[model samples]
Target: MAGERDGETLKRRGLMLVLSSPSGAGKTTISRALLQEDHNLVMSVSATTRPPRPGEIEGKDYFFVEPVDFNLMINRGELLEHAKVFNHYYGTPKGPVDAALAEGRDVLFDIDWQGTQQLAHKARADLVSVFILPPSTAALEQRLKTRAQDSAEVIASRMSKAAEEISHWSEYDYVVVNDDLERCLAEVKAILTAERVRRTRRIGLIDFVSGLRQGY
Candidate 1:
């Protein structure tokens, strides 16, 4: 918690830190770095139809589900946000996210602009959205190509999409240019520190302050 602390009391609400970017913009890497650095934060694991890669465990990387089950979640309003990506439906399940926030734990999101917008509308008070941009178009193209799975055509498609995605940068509370990974991570860490200290999140502060004044 980043706010004022009186005596040995705990205050402050949990935060939803959303990091959004186009495919090659390094949001995922930055999110992982943030999690490693902060013990109080955890990544919001998404449920997807996408298959797990070689080393990824079922629940650890993502909650792999069949299309029917995913649609069931969507229909039942069990998903906080859902979107179709590259023919697969992916979403954040409402249960775990709600439970984590209620426990005063910060949750991180690596999602697209659409998902970000949904989260904002659903939990505006708890949301802190950040958009990440690569230094240049050429750099973004190169980064996309670095992945062997994507063809040149796919990379080009992603690059084109990146332009559209970056246009929504104004919607976010913070924008970070990922020219260097370490420096970008440091900036994100600072934002988290500042958000934790926000007065609205610290619900226990007023009572704590009053007790302090009374010399309790």
Candidate 2:
């Protein structure tokens, strides 16, 4: 549909922008930048069975929970999507995401391809999935190694998993090869703008246009 200036015909629905990438592909950094720049966007805090890292806040970095509690959420259908990664269960809760979308706010999900798939199936209309890839496999390995948090063995494991993760690129709606973070962030912002202005999202446009015809 064409752009309508009428107030009643330009209402927007909430959007779910899922960013999927390998462990070292920079989705976390890009997602944070997007949240900082976009006032209407909120990051979806995942519930995890893993312990919080040193400086990581409980409700901010993740909703740290026991394994049993994580399993309970999965069984209760409280999580929009849940997956086991590196021996820890991570999931996006249903309540907050639904509430945010209902309020016409966008929720940013930093998750893997598996979680993205589940979110797509659950919130098919609201989702705008994006996959991020490193500029090259060599760059990906270098990035993983530069992170001092992992040991040599762990880094190798992550590098191995990266290949499998990159294989799912075709499943997502959009793809960004993150050679330059700033340019990638700009592209992401453009995608969000376009998705928000999509015809189906502006439900009130029809009525506003109708009113305009009477005035004309």
Candidate 3:
């Protein structure tokens, strides 16, 4: 879609952009930067059965619900996609994402490969999934340790799981190596920009083109 302007016509359909990567591979950092720079992009808030991490906020970082409540949401069909990771339930709420898509606003998801697959099966047309990779295992481990959020044991566990997470990279539409954070962010933004204007995603394209032809 063209850049947003006041009173602009020719509305464009929005998309669901999923960014999946192993823990501490910079998906979250890239997501934060993308949201900061793109006014049209909105973050998808997931409800999780896990306790809040430091500096995490309710309704922003996550919904932070009990396991029973999370299960209830699942049984009630409130989640667009739900998955269990490390014995905790995490899910994307369906209502908010549907509302954002209806309003022609893009929803950015920082989820796992499982959630991405679920969304693809549900709404593949609106989905643009990207898998971010670390430059190397050593680099990935270093980045995880640098974040200081996890203990040695937790870091080791994450490192062990990274291989399995990365094995699903082929399922994504795009794969970016996060050797340089800024460059990776730029590449992800480029993909978003190109996808937004795809012929199928724009509404009323045939009519708009016909009107233009008549003007000649």
Candidate 4:
């Protein structure tokens, strides 16, 4: 439906669809679901100084780089946003994102509040940010424990940080509570569908309207 046409084909400028949430709040799950369903949406692969895990392909999972190279990219303004987490640097490369948007392909960003703020400051018109929240703090903690990926100490740290993360909910354009996964996914999809058709986003609407006027 994104490139659908009634008379003259309508073209839209691709938007940066950002989904940010504290750990275990369902942002990753929702992002995966959206990418699977939407052919035009692609995840923005980031460059990281961290080593890849088993079966992780370079340029696919991430562009694994050396710390020196990462620093060079940052210095050269090639990175759209960069952050240090747990002694590793991760960043979004500006080139790929710019190319994707220019070609009318939406780029999905699974980043934090810091990255979202940086993106908003750089490209406010092209950004559509959503913050996901858990139904309750208890639920959030449970979800983190169920993953079993972290130690109790790490989980505790994450739970402590979640509150501070949730405090930034007002900064996002939309907020969805992940009480029910299916319902939340549907609501997010609806938001994307509506955003795609917005008059301002549809870049070709003016030309289409002009054609109609000429016919009249």
Q: Write the per-residue lDDT of candidate 2 for residues 1-216, one digit (tens) a residue.
A: 344355435668889999989888899899889988899999998999999889999888899999999889988999999988779988998998899888889999888888888988888899999999899988988898887889989999988888899899999999998999999999999999999999878777677768678883
Q: Which segments of candidate 1 are over 4 A away from where they belong?
A: 1-8, 50-55, 147-149
Tens digits of per-residue lDDT for model 1, 1-216: 323344236556789999999888888889877888789999888999988789988877899999999999988989989999889988999898888887789999888788999998888999999999899888888888887779888888888788889999999999999999999999999999999989888866777778768975
Clashes per model (N, Cα, C within 3 A): 2, 2, 1, 0
Q: Model 3, range 86-152, lDDT digits (tens) per residue?
A: 7998899999898888789999998888888999988899999999999999999999889989999
Itemize residue pairs with steric clashes in candidate 1. 2-197, 3-197
Worst 10 residues of 3 by lDDT: 1-10
Better of 1 and 4 by lDDT: 4
Q: Write the per-residue lDDT of candidate 4 for residues 51-124, one digit (tens) a residue.
A: 99999999889999999999999999999898999899999999999998887889999999999999998899
Top candidate, metric TM-score: 4
List the lowest-lDDT window of 10 residues for candidate 4. Answer: 1-10
**Per-model lDDT:** 0.87, 0.89, 0.91, 0.91
Score candidate 1 by lDDT. Answer: 0.87
RMSD of candidate 1 to the true fold?
A: 3.1
- Compared with the true structure, the alpha-carbon lDDT of candidate 4 equals 0.91
Model 2 has an lDDT value of 0.89
Give TM per candidate: 0.88, 0.87, 0.87, 0.93
Displacement of the residue 19 alpha carbon in candidate 1, Å: 0.9
